[model samples]
Target: MIEPTHYLSSTVKGLKPSGIRKFFDLAASMEGVISLGVGEPDFVTPWNVREASILSLEQGYTSYTANAGLLELRKEISYYLQEKTNVSYSPSEELLVTVGASQALDLALRAIVNPGDEVIVIEPSFVSYSSLISLAGGVPVSVQTSGEMEFKLQPSDLEKAITDKTKAVILCSPNNPTGTLLNKEDLEKIAAIIEKYDLLVISDEIYAELTYDDVYTSFVSIDGMVERTILVSGFSKGFAMTGWRLGYVAAQPEFLSAMLKIHQYTMMCAPSMAQYAAIEAIKNGKEDVLHMKKSYRQRRNLFVNALTEMGLTCHVPGGAFYAFPSIKETNLSSEEFAEKLLMEERVAVVPGSVFGESGEGYIRCSYASSLEQLQESLRRMQRFVQKQKAGV
Candidate 1:
């Protein structure tokens, strides 16, 4: 018999499926499941953005765009970054459009990682960072963060993780699963370490616009940091444009050119209409982004309060739309807690262990759904917790 597994690359065979998707799949099979697992926004793409894409199609702008993406879109992205973060990037030489922030990260890794080069990854982060690093022929060294520190990556830990072979570090602000935004002071400390080690940085800022903190800071905006940082961002989380398949990377030409080579050979370019619509988004979509951010803030408060009141200690998320609550009181592994909660109460959430070993005693619940849905999921979770306490 022919076997597909035999033909798989070692990397593909070793890679595990995303932990978030496992709960989502289980919830789909069950009736009446209230899911808070995925980090995706439930909001539709704002009308103006959609209209722009539609208009592009109507105008026969369906041809493949330049390999780096539309010049106009790149220009807008440059302006947007400068306006928001005070960072200046040359659109022609320092930016490359990608399928999504995921691809941007992949391109960054592919461009820099030689076999056996080590990349430091902050733990309990988005699941793909380690896997992608491994797939890029780099070794992934995890540095765990803690809820006590609001899951912010510590510079001491980062310094300890580096070795002679270390090449880069991956950072996610307004982090997924944890929702901790790295503030300027902490980032300055990290910048010092990166400078000391001469390591490149892949900064994922997809959730920057959703921050409820003081202001979103860009790694590239930091003095002297732009030369060594590859900034990855997308329209997904902020614009509710997950399906648009649009993202970009900004770096000095040295790194950007290398990443562009991989992108040119692999993806060719991002979708044409999406590139056009993204130009519109950058120019006129601030109001919609703010509106969604306000809604997410309310949901974050509601979800965090509900979790704490139910006896699960939860840190208030500074940004992004997730509430990561400690389930250590139940003495259940994260997977055990999440599975039992879903089986008993028909509520779905991601087990923390999926993100990394440090997440074993917690669970990640996204508040990106409607307030009504979040409330219902909380009620079910509360009842489930009560049952666990009663040992029923």
Candidate 2:
């Protein structure tokens, strides 16, 4: 008898499942669990955007779009980048629409990471970067960021981490979990490092449109970065179209050519109607992003202020819809902190340790739910903290 061992792909075995999923599963089983775990908008797809998809279906536009995606969608992305971020790309030669930023992440890493290559990941980040890099046969080197610096990844931190084996540095701005952003000077410093090391840069700008203080700028907007950076962005966070499954990559034509090979072979094209709807989303649905951003900022301010008032240290996030508060005062590990919060408060949040070792003393709470929900969660959290203090 031949034995079939559980020979998982070496590329995938090191990857951890998403940190956002476990609590979500637990929430699924429990009754009356208020989840602040997942990072998706509570808003519905804009009606006008939906109408375009509805029209596309009515007009029999249901079929396999070009493997790279629809010309119109790519072109819209190209235009949006130029108008919004000052980054330009030729849709014909240098763009690929993917099935959300997740696939784009997978395709980008797989396309460039040779075995043993290193991809620098700033820690306390979204979980997918390292995992996808691992599955692409790349080693992940994590650089820890401090809450004292508002979780900003500094220039010296980046410089200290680079080595001969380093192939690329992945960046998530208005970052997940912490919501920290790289200002222009911060971005320029990283760009200079990339220029010096001749390393690839992949900028995850999925949260670009949700910026609070100023308009979001692509790292490619920095001098000398446009040619080396691969900009990965999508409609999920900005357009409230997470379920629609659409994202895109804009990079130098040579790299785009290579990435499309993986995308064309693995996922033929993004959803057909989604491509059409996204065109409307790019052209007219920007208002939806503005509305959502305004709401998220309010929730962020309320939660941040409330948590700080409750004696928990929360870094004021500039963008993204999460607040990563330190759990050190609770005298519990991050996982223990989260479990206790769920059991004691009926509020669900993810442990930061699930992101990486650097996240051990924090928990990520997404404010993407609602004002009322956020207020109630904060109330329960304050009560829980008081109980802990009293118990101490």
RMSD each, Å:
0.9, 1.3
Q: In candidate 2, what are the lDDT values of residues 1-392, reduced to their tens digit?
A: 75444666655555667768988898878887889999889999999999999999999999999999999888888898889877678999988999999888888898899999999999887888888888788899999988888888888989999999999999999898789978888898888889998999999999998889855667999998888888898999999999999999988988889999888778888999999999999999867788888899988889999999998899889898989999888788999889998987899999999887878989999999878898899999999988887774
Report the C-alpha displacement of residue 209, candidate 2, in angstroms. 0.3
**What local lDDT score does residue 387 receive in model 2, on the 0 to 100 scale?**
84
lDDT of 1: 0.91
How close to the true structure is residue 145 of candidate 2, measured as C-alpha lDDT? Answer: 89
Runs with alpha carbons beyond 4 Å of true place in candidate 2:
1-5
Best by TM-score: 1
> Scored by CA lDDT, what does every candidate get?
0.91, 0.89
- Number of the predicted model whose lDDT against the real structure is largest: 1
Give the Å shift of residue 230 in candidate 2: 0.6
Residue runs of model 1 more than 4 Å from their true location after superposition: none
